[model samples]
Target: MKKLFFAAFTLLLSLCSFSQNYQLISGDQIKVSKYSSDLDIVASDKTGNYFAEQRWSWNLRAKLYKFDKNYNDIYEKDYRKELRGSIFRGFYPIDEELVMFSTEYTRKEKTFTLYARKINKTTGEIKQDAKEIGTFPLEDKRDDFEVKFAPVSNGKKLLFAANVSNKDRVSLVTAVLDPQLKREATATIDFRFTPKQFSIQDVFYTANEKIVVLGKESEETQVGKRKKKRWVFKQYILHIYTKAGKKEKEIPITADQRFAISGKLIEHTDGTLALAGFYATDPKKKDLSGFFLSKIDTDKNELLLTSYKEINASMIGQNYTEDADDDNDDDSKKSKKEEKKKDDDDEEEEIPNDYVLKSVLINPADNSMVITAEISQLYVYQTQNRSGNMTTYTTVYSYTTKDILLIGLNAEGKVKWVNSIPKKQQEKYENPNITRSEEDYFSGKTAHPYFSSFAALINKDKLIILMNDHQSNNVNPEYGHKVKRVYNFKKKSNFYGISVDLVTGTMKRKMIYDNSSDGIMMPRSAYINGSTILIPATRVKMFGKNELKMSQLTIK
Candidate 1:
């Protein structure tokens, strides 16, 4: 009997050891300059080869790296001399070629020109000649200039659009390019709204070879009876245009009596449109109470299916408190009773605040969808100082990114399951030094920008989430207790991998590795290539020597 029991226990241990369905491979460390701290994966090819852009702290020029299938760095190219006075836009894979985009502003002519050059994917050699994509005249050299690129038809075609607003109206210079970097069509389209009241949010190339532009428009209106008047969001608009820049349809999306705080538009394969977002009933409050999904019949100008799901406390998981140890105390029991009574007196359900929908994944086979949202908030603190006649004001911003919410929906737009993964992280940045505006800070201009968020991928039947967490979280693998807050990701932080069963919403978590001995892994820089996820890790030393490596996680 003793032998049988021992054998059974051994088998259980082995089963527990093989629970994780993935393998992590850490590549060899390579010495890099101290200024190169962040790496972003720009593009990947069909054969599992990828390209990364290494950013420097001092300049806009970046180094390009080409990695092989096994995460081996095979080629490197520096762009400092080649792009001396130009701003690097991005590197993208259009069709079978890797294209690099850069912009040059000629102060004499007050013109900003966008140039695109081809790069050899395997050799990392950039072509000397560049093709001019667009040119815009600017009133001032300091004015903001941006060019938007959208890939369509499984990356077989590219769309470029830029705002060329004038005094009277807002206009966009749009162009469509084929795989060979040849312009198929170019035209200027009017937005029909003033620049101050409307802003373009996103551009999409539809499945039927059409252009869809999403814009947000705001207007001022009276709110209260007399003196409490204010302005808020008016409506969101969508303009659908043909490939030749002819406007086909203009649709305005509005929530009945409620404010649509945030939303995302999705284009189906059959030329249908869907909208998903969060909503708030009270205009005075920014907290969202429910989420809605709607499918639209564009031709009929009506909604085919609309579903609204209220987010309650139970959907966000139990609120675990640190006072569990004090449960036996009399005062604690009394306090809990009073809190419970107060909760019972209130009729409104507790809901999550500052949650933003991040990504929506649609399964190709059945059209079932999974949506992911995160709690992101920014608090600004101000301080004033007086030195004789000179008065100075300083500002500091505290950024918080918390729990991740996952919701699953069937093909008919019905909610199947909902789950929340607990996590807490905070990052602080001071003004006048690092960033000039909140938008710049949110764009990752601060130090240690990629340490706070998570990277996620949806595999065949599972949703995988990778994040840097506090070391103590490994003690309770079931995630029953309150998540320990990680103020900063450092060497002591542990990298965690969570796998969720898509159908049942069941989750399993494990600490994949610790950064105590290796280095700090940036999860936000992770990208999926085929069945593998690649992340960049960096270790900075006291001097100018730094070590960089690639970590790959392959789903088994």
Candidate 2:
């Protein structure tokens, strides 16, 4: 009888081990830079076979690494050494062996040029000489210039657009280039608006081989014919242009005055337009109070503006962790204090509204769209003295991410449900207010090491949120469900995932893999291609040198 019991116990343990969400694929490891921000993973044409990564150094020096189907590094090289003072715009994959990149250079005085180069995928070498396609004349140091490249005509043609601004005038120059970098058609649009009033959000390719530009332009209206000099916010504007850059139709989306649209817009597979952002209820307060989702039917020229969801305590995963505080003695006093404060004031817990909208993804399986947002804020620190006084003032920036809000919208642009994956990530900024060093002129340390680190994988019936293990046993779970004690092979932990049901809004948190025995995974570097998820990690050994590794997880 005792032998039978031992055998049953071993069987149960084996069953639990095999039932994990992700299985690690070993033996595919390489060397990489310690800084995760420098790595950019590009999904290749071969669905789940191979991919490419571009790493940039502190001085904007770039190196491309190509990996094979088994996650083995095959080749790496540095291209375009002559164009040192250029900014990489985008990469276009023409075929399996050929890729092209666009860069904007502002080297000469009062001159800006856009260059395109074709790259060999196998060897990471430039296929042809870098060609200067277009140039823009700058106006002093205050002039703003930007160039973007997009693949139109079903990835057969490339469309390049440049936004040049001087004083109160902004000109948009667009050119369609073929695979040989030859410009087929070019046109320019000039418009005038208040300084900082007009901004181009995104340019996308339409199904009919035309281009659509999503923009936001603020307009001012007089109150009671008194001309109070107040600039009121208007609606979002859409400009549809033909292949030759001729303006075909101008569609205006009349939005609520309380809300603001983000620069990220989605042109869906079915000819519908959607935008995800925030709205403010209080006019005086410039902060966002809720999530705003707008769906536009371009065929009928109808806009839907009734899909706004408010951020509440329940949406931030506060309800689940609240009950666990009662059982733990160490947290009892803190929980009591919070309850006392709540009772003292007959008011509800104020949910924070400083979340910045990140991405709006569409799921054609169910005609549902998911909105992902994170809490982001900036702080400025300055040291000032009056009359020979030596004093220092430290202002810590809130680059920390408190929680990520996820909202689901159904086919009719109605709110399906809302959920939040709670997390706390904090770090200091190198400068006054810059969070990401890659965005600033000077490459410095990141504000929060894990600010925007979590990855959300959206599916038809569920969504998975994956990140590095930060909570472990430190976070309390709901009282009823027994939280499993996680064990790491080494001192450090591996990756964890929170799976949420799309329809019921139910969430289950579990450790995907305890890979501490091998390497420390950078969850922020995780990428999804079809049903496969790839994560890069750092492997430290007891002797010898450390190496960079990647984990491939296949979803069944």
Candidate 3:
């Protein structure tokens, strides 16, 4: 298994050529220095064609960029002419045409329309066939709900997750589109949730439409008291939906108290479906590991297939006794000093044992369901900084690891061999502002990390995740502005992109275009192109102005 994993890894890298400075497979690294104030990569056609709508500003001005088979610039135009809000939502393909849409932002008391447009594949012209599907009611102003596009049986469906602005009540709206992408039929779902002291983190179905949604919905209750009170996440929940919104089954990740579901649904040509994701359980006192795999399941929701366990992240810790040098006395003395130092280091910082991406996939045999997930780590540190710092100095700090965890379950839902990915090195980033802390952090606000990572499920067991590099601009010396210091306490995290193994939860690739090295990582947006991945990166103009830069990577 190790040899096979290595062979596959080597082959992936060999398929492309990358220089330390930049990575490219086709198209000279074009310097597209435009800011996509907001953007979304709709979908890559089966032929590997990419199309997306990139909004350039907070003021509702933006354009669309399309790429051909070779990733060459096919066309670009301003799609947001009179559209009020240009916040990006998602992309989907119908037949031979591409459809893209952005969220509607409200300005003033009046409400605007939620627009969806179709693009002409051959001419690369923007088709004004855009129509407003729904409106954001005054009672539904919360940012938790968003629209996602998926290919349905005939045309396509837009899945909108709706929940009460400040309540636990959640609703799933499935809007089927017509040939021109007009909303035809809609399904309102109360969906399903457990009453076991858990939250619905994600909601989606399998590739072949088998219902499967993942969430770190732990049976957690507060323990301890006041300042010392802590919430323990016991495990992960994997749900299989054999029927549409009717029947469902649940499973638990039983390794460590920590498991994160990251990946998508896969529909195979041979009438099989699978789910790809991983978990981060405490291997020892120091290792946070993960594994990725393709799960198989059938309509009845029985565990018929599973894969070999793959390692996600593992650290070399003080838990292991030292392999002393030949000189015992001197080495022993040094070891004692190092041991003390190691303990001190452990107090303030916690290493990321594993990182699983949250993505969805489909089974080629039948595009029946979707894969939705919201998996969180079992044991993670909630770093609090109250030392006069008003700005959130949040960033995903990375650590190295070896060992990839891979698992798979089949359509019959049989557990496959849980494989271990013995990778040599791995990397991780700090997530901020997403986790829940009953007591607001530092200045009375939640400071838990956001899952700034995303993934895409492709052919084979090969999955791709772009773990976003996040950092606060107000605190960043190079990026921060003077007056902006006043707003430091309320800034959001930014993202840069990285590639990791979906099966083994390992960093298979990393490249930063704007900074030469992995300076300030930002996942401006990404698009899939054959064996290559095109990521658009932006850097503030050298003159303190915003200037966007683009980076394209050919993954071997």
What's the TM-score of every candidate structure? 0.80, 0.71, 0.54
Candidate 1: stretches off by over 4 Å = 1-19, 32-38, 46-48, 54-59, 164-170, 221-231, 268-272, 283-285, 296-305, 317-353, 379-398, 429-448, 475-481
Clashing pairs in 1: none
lDDT of 2 by residue, 510-556 (tens): 66666565566655657676556777666645465446555676544
Cα lDDT of model 3 by residue, 74-174, tens digit = 55655555445455444567766676665564655434345677766666566775677766543344443444454555434444333322244444444
lDDT of 1: 0.66
- Give the candidate number with the greatest TM-score: 1
Give lDDT per model, in order: 0.66, 0.55, 0.40
What's the residue-level lDDT of 98 in candidate 2?
A: 46
Model 3 TM-score (2 dp): 0.54
Candidate topping lDDT: 1
RMSD of each: 8.9, 9.3, 12.7
Q: Per-residue alpha-carbon lDDT of model 1 for 142-182, expressed as tens digits?
A: 54464667676667878777776666667777777786788
Model 2 Cα shift for residue 495 (angstroms): 2.2
